[model samples]
Target: MTEPVPAASAPSGGCPAHADVLPLYGPRFLRNPSELYREMRQEHGPVVPVLLEGDVPAWFVIGYREVHHVLSHPEVFARDCRRWNQWDDIPPDWPLRPFVGYQPSTLFAEGDEHRRRAGAISNGLFAVDQFDLRLRSERIADDLIDAFAGRGEAELMAEYAHPLPLLALAGIFGMPEEETPGLLRDMMTTVNGDEGALDAYQGICATMERLVAHRREQPGPDFVTRMLNDPANLTEEELIADLVLVMTAAQQPMAYWIGNTIRLMLTDDRFSLNLAGGRRSVGHALNEVLWEDTPTQNYLGRWAARPVLLGGQQIDAGDLLVLGLAAANGDPRVRPASDTPALGNQAMMSFSYGEHRCTYPAPELAEVICQAAVEVLLDRLPDLLLAVDPEDLEWSPSVWMRGLVGLPVGFTPV
Candidate 1:
């Protein structure tokens, strides 16, 4: 377990100008948080607490070393309700207040309860070699590309990244293919938006209820059914919640990872040429791409468990702390050679680390992106380049899932 690292320069807390907010999520930067983050890292320096959503307080910790400290001490820096900022919108009777009643996913859970659940679920990915589902992953990757190959070109993220991981979850749950579209739609609406997220969440909750109900009568060796069958592991509600957590685990990041990596390579002719050949260094390019830009802007919040001096500033037990994975990944202290082109994996901060680490198969995810998506794009579309000039493409205005809104490429139909 990595311990929280003190900010070498320390944090300067409290509200940044409201004017700065627009640029942070403005029409231009939302499409690419990295550009905003890079600019902010230069302007804001390191740690700064900006009151957001009209006075919901949060400390946006930007330094890589500082982010490590906060996540490593998750026992001290809790991920539960204490960190939530539910400013003016709380009805005393609301069943699931964003701050208090929410249990987002197992990744953010704290204490014995977190261990009770996380320990059980971690088995599927990291435990006793009980499930080596590698071949299944390769099969899915090949099939996805095979479906799109005849088109001569496709939007790799939508055609592949977005649906594939969700299908991996479906495959894990033994769900049928017909459910994939709805499941994909369900996840996209639920996770990406800040507005209407609560309503979108209700749809996901209802979908989970039905999925759970469907599985009870037709139990199997899938992740959900396995958890359902194990009385020691999951209660009914917990099983449903856990499925929501697991399904969302690597969904968007992997999608953005696929898109971002391809974008990075193709835009930079040097990397593009390396990728076109499908060398061993494709692994390196994947590493470099992840380090170059991560998908999510703000990390899921972690709270101060008790009073502590962070960055030499006093933080109360319940104060909210946000580790800017987007910022930290690019922080030169952690990555002095971040801008330098290299294939070495010095641990990209994209999926995050520590107790609240990513639940999906990222290495496999990277392999799939390279093996199927990136290679196919290069080999198939030799003449198929970005539809517009690289500078002309537009990006989604999302703080969390940064990707091109549309990548219209003019290609010869080979």
Candidate 2:
């Protein structure tokens, strides 16, 4: 836990514009957000007024119950980004625009429209053969391990953790083998919300457009084709845009899930005992990462559909509320002690909650991908150990993601 810093003055129960809000970005937050969440919860209740990049004001929902409340009551805290009242101040090139900027995607849709797209997506994903997915994931993992098994050392993040999910996803989409690497690059760039994010997002959309067009002409036993044939009858525009949303939702988080689980197994003594051949330990490590170090930490989030009092603060219509998933998982009212491993508990809010949560079989599919990636690597390199000190393994700097920058490790040569 990090040392406590002085909290910003509490919200005046009025417009957040005048409040002395906490800035959500910066090195401190990227380095240790749980400690900051703890301090914020102590000072202000669960809902704290916070400033995003460019001093944009929003509410950060940190309490377990409070986050559950916000997610459950979509009528009050809605998904539509257009309801935001700060658009007047936002520029087209804002770094965070990709998050709040409305597209025709299912991510920001609400009510019946959301169900249509979500239902189609769920059905499409449900159609995926879990056994086939596992087989493909194992093959991909084996291929990735082969490249580094001889060297006796590797940086797992770039070489293994990141690529495995994308590679598997590409196969599911029936994307050409040569096109996947570029797709992977653009997807990473887009999600990081950095300098080239907008361009990369456009590139992703263009690629999706071409894929949809090709599938329309020549349907196959792939996810895109399944969605195209769904009963929802999504328009070409909706299919293209929502395909981007699907990729965005699946790839990055799955990568971090694999990476964080491996990190836990390597660093924690409990997991080390079973590192060589314990599926049970691997399962525990994966679950524990979801509770303690969820990949999607904070989501760009619900807008207040109308003025309402919540957590002792009066939220005005059009106010934005960021869901604090990691913080909620650590809430003292519900979570176990910091030192205790959350082994069997699957109730963590890591995959948000409510209708907007990761839909049905999608989470199941992600688990198949992630579990296969970890199990295969362990089977191949049972003696894997961190090359650098545990403290030296730095995390990615993005406030939205919780993943290592790189995970360098070494093992005996095969």
On lDDT, the leading prediction is 2
Off by over 4 Å in 2: 1-15
Residue 191 error, candidate 1, Å = 2.3
Candidate models: Cα lDDT each: 0.62, 0.89
Query: Taking the tens digit of each residue's C-alpha lDDT, what string does model 2 give over 292-380?
Result: 99999999999999999888888999998999999999999996577788879889998899999998888889999999999999988
Each prediction's TM-score against the native? 0.82, 0.97
Candidate 1: worst-modelled 10 consecutive residues by lDDT: 2-11
